[model samples]
Target: MKNTLKISLKAGEKIYVNGAVIRVDRKISLEFLNDVQFLLQQHVLQPEDARTPLRQLYFIVQVMLMGQAGEGMEKTRQLFRDTLANLLSTFRNERIRAELKHIDTLVGQGKVYEALKAIRALYPIEEQIFNKDSLQEEQVFAKAVGE
Candidate 1:
């Protein structure tokens, strides 16, 4: 049996369901009793906002979710896998690296939404790693100048 899903939306909120975007002008509650694919507006990333490599992947998956799965699904899936492979190759953090496998599983099962969430959660770690690298470089540069 499919567990029912209840979603409450405020005015002007949007939800993408099965590749269709629906916006409510007023407060509303919705329930889905069957299998449904839906994404909240807050999680939606615009094209320009996808500046980071991970975010770019998110945007591409979002396009597939946005109803482009007809003619370009194979292409999208290939790209997602390729990008994920590259990430796995270079990611230094064990936590993030481990998640790549789970994310791949989700994407392979057509659970792109869950895959996106897993990737999104890794962003803070990615930023922290980048910041640490920058700080280390600055320290090294300062040490060389002082020597």
Candidate 2:
């Protein structure tokens, strides 16, 4: 079975896919594009499914880091980073709330690595919204304590 997907490109161009890209002359809605991209990044398209594109991306990164460089790996990494940044910007409130909850959970369990991973993930977007020095201080202290 073949599945069709629609993606909007920058400059109001719409691309359709039946597993292959086809250009459409009509202008695409940026809001629609943003919504689709956000949903993909958040793994919301199949909320009950075990496998998702985001999970696939994470697995791809892990596999790439293991051995042999694959074609377009750098582009894949950049796409993941850009998608994550976009999601962070578009869902700032929800993302921040989720981050705080994760932080509390990690701290309670004494899982410094997981907490640091979460912080680093948010650092790109949260740097402007949060106090960097204080976060770094806490991270350093956690490291010093063998966490």
Candidate whose lDDT is highest: 1
User: How would you encode candidate 2's per-residue C-alpha lDDT over 12-73 as one tens digit per residue?
Assistant: 34332212233445645433322121212222122244143333333333322322235665
Task: Kindly report which residue stretches of model 2 are placed more than 4 angstroms away from their true locations once superposed.
Answer: 1-71, 94-147
Model 1, 134: alpha-carbon shift in Å? 1.6
In order, the Cα lDDT scores of the candidates are 0.85, 0.43
Off by over 4 Å in 1: none
lDDT of 1 by residue, 1-147 (tens): 978999999999999998999999999999999877789999999887988767877887777666675559778878887888898898878998898888888877878788878879988988898889999999999999999
Provide the TM-score for each candidate, comma-separated.
0.91, 0.25
Extract clashing residue pairs from model 2. Answer: none
Clash count, predicted structure 1: 0
